[model samples]
Target chain A: MRTTIMPSVRILIFFTILTGILYPVGITFVALGIFPYQANGSMVERNGRVVGSELIGQGFTGDRYFHPRPSAIAYDPVPSGGSNWGPTDARMADSVAARRDAFIRKNGVPGDVVVPKEMLFASGSGVDPHISPDAALLQMERVAAARGFDTQKSDALKELVMRCIEPPQYALFGEPRINVLSLNLALDALEKGYPPPF
Target chain B: MITVSELIQLMLYALALFLLTPPLGKLMAMVFRGERTFLTPALGWLERVAYRVSGIDPDKAMDWKGYLWSLLSFNAFGFAVVFLLQFFQSSLPFNPQQLPDVSWHLAFNTAVSFMTNTNWQSYAGEVTLSYLVQMLGLTVQNFVSAATGIAVLLALVRGIAGRSTGSIGNFWADLTRSIVYLLLPLSIILSLFLVSEGVVQTFSGSRTVTTLEGVQQTIPLGPAASQVAIKQLGTNGGGFFNMNSAYPHENPTPFSNFLQMLSILLIPSALVYMFGAMVNARRHAWVVWGVMFFLFAAGVTLSLWSEYTVNAVTGVGGGMEGKETRFGVANSILWSVATTAASNGSVNSMHDSFSPLSGTVAMMNIMLGEIIFGGVGAGLYGMMIFIILTVFIAGLMVGRTPEYLGKKIESFEVRMAAIAMLLPSAGILLFTALASVADAGLAGLNNQGPHGFSEILYAFASTAGNNGSAFAGLTANTPFYNTLLGINMLIGRFGVIVPMLAIAGSLAQKKITPLSSGTFPTDTFLFGVLLTGTMLIVGALTFIPAQVLGPVAEHFLMLNGKVF
Candidate 1:
């Protein structure tokens, strides 16, 4: 027992230093050297001021910008979580109903048309950064109206939104999504010429 | 109303898994046998250096008792180190977040969880653990604990193959080789892929940025892709972010999501084939794999149907509330079933938001002993336990001594197998019952009535099964849950492992008997059905009452438009 214990403890300590410290540090350097932009949170900038991470959702309430999915945690990164509300939970039902009503009133969409599920439901991570391309398109008219664009500009804006549509990775994995942060950053870029957010 | 595209995706996933299993299994068998492989030249030096530095005689086998002692002591040391690290986290390097020391109970729970390969987090990672602890303390355990599982399984395999030998293979050798040859190389490739797909891998602190709405938001960053790789590949599912895989940074693109999902089942599923090659029972291995595949397919189908069916509350056809829209309904439901079945418990969607029937399927997958494709090496040994019981029952019906793979079913082996089988079930039931009635337990309940009961039930079930996914509704950070769950994780992991080793010890000492006309063929379709039936019966008999009190009742209540 003693023989096993001493060697096992020593090995544990050795592996801890190897895996815990050296491995991650090694990986960190490689990632930084090769994929620096992504490895460092993929932050988008405008006029030398950092705006938001491309990976996380931002609170975009103005009709001029397409909103991200409803965040259950108010988009807080430090303590990210889901609402964890069951479909049958009364509070969840109430919140969904409230979100649906708000979506109809604010977006001025016809009630008869089925609102996309992403528009009505709070995402798993209150910090979901994407809305489906269809969801984004539904709010396109409102975003164009908010920006005070003419028909020609609105058509170009729609083209810009189409560019923001990320195809399903591998052509079969996830759904097509428009990053709200990127789209809104593009909206800012339209007003002032700047490189588009990645 | 399952879409053709969803069916295609499922078919692709199954096809990919089938195609990948044999070569991986062959490579693993080579590793375990200390033979030459493609990776030997690259990783062989590390294996030799590990043994030399630790003074472990790679050729020296130990009796089952010695193996168990080494396993237990090593894990104990790991637990102590992790506990101490959390207590003194404020002083640790890489804590750019300036996190405080973890409370005593949480430190205890976290320590036991990682050491046991449970990875059940009561607190969010970025907020609680320093990067030092996440990497050194938790991530290190992710590799070693998973290696420990594979090590034990190797010992068991040696025991089955031995002829009157008292010694199983060296635990140290098995553990070292598993990490050096298998886990390390796989993790490096997977991590690089994940980083390419934009999963964050950095040492920088959280970045505060101004949003389009003009609100200041802080985005957390760290060495996430590195941890995410091993976390999924090793079947240790601790998440860097609190939202787990649902966080875009941790599982950014659909390609990343698909890769992570595939890696979860890769090792465990391959291990079944490895077992067959080791014991010279390739046919038997495929039969067992077939049984596991059937169960996995059934689970995925049930979850998909339930998720797509109309719910009474919203009067909606699809249950998409807690699912990530990028993964959509099919991917989320598929991920939920795969994660649960493999005991790789990182969720791309919240299980708590799943409709009752879907939630029930998730719970049932864990309750079925997580052997559809369980965590790393643990799943195969666990399924073997059920197989022993099936053979034992068959012996009684035939009025003859039962044999499996040419080994006679002895009293001692049967008793030890029973202990291995029952201990986790006991932990799940007793702890859940106690928590249901206790004030300390009730304090953490986030929902009312049946769903609340389901949360409590899911916690213990996850802990006991060593499947770390949670209902996510329960606030398990309190002292009561931390200590109780800590103990539960230990019992669930080691309690079963000890008896399994004992069975291995007993079997190793017995001489192999020749097969007869009535040896009860384990490779037959009837035996597969019988083995699966034994698993279902044990699970149903033990957990149906609790399931009724929780998800089962919740299902019926939801039909009546009742919300808990």
Candidate 2:
């Protein structure tokens, strides 16, 4: 017992410093050296001001911009989480219905046109950056109209959405989706006749 | 109902795992044997330094008692450091978020959870833990606890491979080798890859950013990539942030998600092959791998079907709630099955909002004691217990003694195996019942009726099985849950480990018998089927009643358009 205790404490302390301090700190340095843009939270700058991270979603309520998925935590990056509403929970059904109604009304889509499920359901992480391409397309009419785009400009806007659509990584993983922040940023760029964000 | 693309992706993932297994497994076997490998040139010096600094004689072996004692004492000391660190977190350095000291019960729960390799987080990470606690306390435990598991397994392997020997292996040497040779190098590479894909690795505090629409959002940043790598690789699923892998910065892209999912099963799956190499039973290892793969595939298929099908009550076409759009149904369901099966409970999607039947498959994976490619070394040992039971039953049918790898499976080995098998089951069921009747448990539920019951059952099953994935809806940070779940995590971990070491000790002292026609062949295809059957029967018979009251009952209620 005595033999075990001394070695145990010594070994624990040794590992604690090695793994706890040196490993993570070492990784941080290497990552910063190689991938500074990504390692430092992938923040996007607009006109030299930090606007938001490209990977993190922020709530966009205006008709001029494409909204991200409904956030359970209202797109708060800190203290992030989902609604965690069980499928059979009435509250889930109620919220989905409410979100669906809002989506149809806000976008001025035909009542009969199916709303994308991504638009109705809150994401697991409140700050999920991407939305399905279908979900983004449904909002194009409202976004283009708010920017006062004609039919030709709407077609160009649609093309921009197509360009913004990121296929699953290597075209084999995850869903084909669009980054809402980047798309909305691109929308601003296109309207102002500036270069595309991506 | 599965699409062609989803099918192709699943197959690709499986092929990747199958291809990576042999090399990783061989590397591990060499490391544990203290043989020279490619890594020895770079890492051999570190191992020697660890031994010298700790005053450990790496060549000196210990009996099973000494090995177990050393492991427990080290873990107990770890538990103390983690617990105390949480209490003094406000005073500790690197608390950029300025989070307060954790409450005592929650601290106890977090300590027990991480120390046991369960990583069942009751408190949110970004909001609760400081960088110092996250790094020194939790991340440190992630490496050591996983190393401890692999070390115990190495001891057991030595015991099995030994001939008329009392000494198993040196615990310190095994533990150090696991970190130095296997976990550290793998983690560094994975962490760097994840950083390249946008998983955060920084010392800076949360950045308050202005949105395009002029809203302020606080983006939490940390040395997340480093921890995320090990949390997946080690099967210690505690997340750096509250949303775990679901948060975009933590997982970033679909490619990152695929790799993280792969990392969850990487070590556990390879450890099966390592077991084979060490015991000189390569064919038997493949058979074990086959059974684990079969169980895992079945769970994934069922979860996909349930998730893809329209919800009967809500009439939703796809079960998209609480899932990220980028992952969609297939990736989310695959991750769900993989995480639970491997006992790597870090989630890219919320399990609570899954369709009732989909939720059941995830719950069932843990209830099976996480041996369907379970936690790093813990999974192989847990499956070995089942293997022992299968051989014993086969021996009984043929009216001869059971022999596994030339060692006779006598009464002592059988008894220890039974204790190992039964303890986790008892911990899960008993704790669920206790929590169910208590008002404190009832108060924590996010959903009512049977679904609420599922929340309580899932919590206990997760803790007692030492698989930390939560149903998430259960408000489990309260005193009642923290204390109960903490106790159960200890029981789930050591209960199996203690008995497993006993069996290893007993096996080491026993003389090997020559193979005869009467001996049940464990490496045969027939034995794989029998082993799979025994595992299912034991798991089903033990937990089916509780499962019925929870997910099963909820399934029927869901079909009937019942909402709670």
Most DockQ-accurate candidate:
2
lDDT tens readout by residue for model 2, B260-352: 999999999999999999999899999999999999999988888778777767677566788898788888999999999987899999999
**Candidate 2 ranges with C-alpha deviation above 4 Å:** none
lDDT of 2 at B300: 89
lDDT of every model, 2 decimals: 0.87, 0.91
Off by over 4 Å in 1: A192-198
**A1-198 per-residue lDDT for model 1 (tens digits):** 779888888899778877787788888899889888888877777779888877888878878888877878888877788889876789887877888888878788898767788877777877888888888888888888888888887887888889999887767767788888888888777756555545
Complex DockQ per candidate: 0.76, 0.88
Model 1, span B243-308: residue lDDT tens: 899998898877888899999999999999999999999999999999999999998888888888
Candidate 2: C-alpha RMSD after superposition: 1.0
Per-chain TM-score (chain B), model 1: 0.99
lDDT of 2 at B412: 91
How do the predictions measure up, each by TM-score? 0.98, 0.99
Worst 10-residue lDDT window for candidate 1 chain B reads B314-323
**Index of the highest-lDDT prediction:** 2
